[model samples]
Target chain A: EAGVAQSPRYKIIEKRQSVAFWCNPISGHATLYWYQQILGQGPKLLIQFQNNGVVDDSQLPKDRFSAERLKGVDSTLKIQPAKLEDSAVYLCASSSTGGGGETQYFGPGTRLLVL
Target chain B: AQSVSQHNHHVILSEAASLELGCNYSYGGTVNLFWYVQYPGQHLQLLLKYFSGDPLVKGIKGFEAEFIKSKFSFNLRKPSVQWSDTAEYFCAVNAFRGNTPLVFGKGTRLSVIA
Candidate 1:
């Protein structure tokens, strides 16, 4: 079985530019999540989707960040008009279910640098 | 709000030395604790986890953590560490029973010198 997959292991964008990251969860997984990990900090949850429907996005910055899981399998996270503070590692993770002790499998993550 | 805290930002030790890393969480409700290790150039992998039952949980690579409910602490430990054990260790917590986001610590970088 393949693990969660993400594209563009690294990205560099100028300030005010736009960037997008993609993720594909493991087969049969129902929960997908997007997290932002700033340097010297832990991963912070940005959004979560359960079968194409959002379960939580309270921490997401609506003005510049957006994410969608259209088919409930693959997901896309976008940042429009990026800012210098947006530089961080975008990590995508997925779990097989919504139960206790559910281990989340993470992708390699896409490191972004905004100049 | 739930949050995780790892006090040790970095630690160094010689080969065969014992290791202990401190971790704590804010919420008092039901929780599932986990420790993840990220080797150089590698993605994060589960070191171990604690849900219910035995507070002392053992994980792969000879790592172990003890969950103290009263103290609200879960600390990672290893005996006779090797240089291979050098990596960034993260402590995370899922406060709710299901489908809840994990709150992670800043992580502790362990440097085991041979």
Candidate 2:
């Protein structure tokens, strides 16, 4: 089976501009997630969805960032008025279930560079 | 809030040398631990995971990790390392209850010189 897929392997935007990233998860996967990884840091969870329903998004920046997993197969994460601090690798992952130990498959992340 | 910590930021060793990377988390309740590896120009992949049972868990590519519940630690190890083993390793944790997202530690970059 194919792994998770993401669009625009790299992106560049100016500060205060808006950017959006897309993710298409593995087939039959029930859970999808969006994470932000700054340089030299681990991936930080931005939002998680279990079949079109948000499971957790407490860490998401409500003022600037938003994500949606409509129809439970694909997802999109958007950041408006992007700041320099928002420059990072946007990773998307998918899993089969919500249970622990379920392996999560990741995509080749979209590396964003905000100038 | 749950958090994961990786002690080493970077490490370098000759091929065939032993390898060990330390990871610790701050959480009182039960957890699921995982070690992920990201090779250069590649996406992240699961090296191994520990949910319950044996403390020592073996993964692909001769990688293994020992989970210590009392110490709240999970350290990845390899008996003999190769140049291909050079990659960034990340430690992550997820709580058993609720809809807690997986918490990841700052990764360790390993360089194995031939």
Candidate 3:
């Protein structure tokens, strides 16, 4: 089966600029997630969607970050007025269900460099 | 909030050496443990997971992990290391209830020399 897909493997923008990353989960996966992985750190959850509704997003920096999975298959993460701290690899993952033990398949990720 | 800790930031080993990476999580309730590996220029991939039934779970590529509930630890192990095993390994945890997202550790970078 094909894996999850992400666009524009890399991006560079100045601080305060706006940027967006896109993700397309594997066919039939019901759960999708977005994570931010900074240099030397592990992936941190930004948001999670079960179908079109959000399941968790407590860690998201709502002041500048937003994500939507409107048709239940694809997702977009936006960082408005980006900051230097926002420079990280944005990863997307999906699983067949919302179960905690379910295996999540990840995309190659979008590497963003906010200057 | 749940949190994960990986003891080693980096490790260097020779081929055919043994490997063990320590990971611990802080959470009072039941949880599901996972170890994900990212090779150079590759996306994160599951090395193994532990839910229940067994404390020791074997995964792909001769990797395995032992989940010790008493210690809140799930350490990854490989009996014999290879250069191909060099990568970044992350430990993550999520509530067993299935509503929470995985909390990840800082990750450990392993370098295996031939």
Candidate 4:
């Protein structure tokens, strides 16, 4: 089985510009997630979706960031008016279930560089 | 809020040397622990995980981690390090609350020189 897939492995945008990242999770996976990983730091959860319903997005920046997992198979994370601080790798991961011990699979990630 | 912490930012050792990377988490309730490794130019992959039962959990590539509930720690170790073991290691925690996302630590970069 193929792993999670993401588009545009790298991206560059100017401050205040808008950027979006796409993710296609593994087949039959029921949960999808978007995470922001700053350089030298761990991946931070931005949003999580179980199927088409959002499970958690408390840490998401409502003012500038948004994500959607329509149809429950693919997801897109968008950042408007991107700031220099938003220049980080945007990762997409998927899991089979929301169980405590379930392992998550990650994509290659889109590395964004905001100038 | 739950958070994970990795004590070492970077580690270096010669091939065949022993390796140990410390990971600590702050959570009062029952939780699951995992160790992930990201090789150069590769995506993150699970090395091992601990949910219950044995404190010592073995994973792929001869990697193992010991989960200490009282200490709130899950430390990764390898008896003998290989050059291929050079990668970034991340520790994550997931609480029993089914829908919660896994909280990850900053990560540790390990370099094994031949």
Query: Model 1 Cα displacement at A64 (Å)?
Result: 0.5
Q: List model 3 lDDT by residue over B15-57, tens digit each.
A: 9999999999999899999999999989999999998898999
Worst 10 residues of 2 chain A by lDDT: A96-105
Q: Which docking category, incorrect, acceptable, medium or high, applies to candidate 3?
A: high
Stretches off by above 4 angstroms in model 3 are none
lDDT for each residue of candidate 4 in B1-114, tens digit (9 for 90 to 100): 799999999999999999999999998799999999999999999999998899999999999999988899999999999999999999999986577788999999999999
Query: DockQ: which candidate is best?
Result: 3
Ordered from best to worst DockQ, the candidate numbers read 3, 4, 2, 1
lDDT of 4 by residue, A6-114 (tens): 9999999999999999999999999999999999999999999999999899999999999988898999999998999999999999999877799999999999999
Q: Which ranges of candidate 2 are over 4 A from the true structure?
A: none
Clashing pairs in 1: none
Kindly list the interface RMSD, in angstroms, of each predicted candidate in the order they appear: 1.2, 1.4, 0.8, 0.9
Chain A TM-score from candidate 2? 0.98
In candidate 4 chain B, where is summed lDDT lowest over 10 consecutive residues?
B94-103
Show where candidate 4 strays beyond 4 Å: none
**Model 1 chain A lowest lDDT segment of ten:** A96-105
Candidate 1 lDDT over residue span A1-115, tens digit each: 9988999999999999999999999999999999999999889999989989999999999999999999888999999989999999999999987565888889999999999
Off by over 4 Å in 1: none
Q: Give lDDT tens digits, candidate 1, residues B3-105.
A: 8889999999999999999999989689999999989988788899999899999999999999998888999999889999999999999965868888899
Q: Candidate 4: deviation at residue A68, Å?
A: 0.9
The CAPRI-style docking tier of model 2 reads: medium
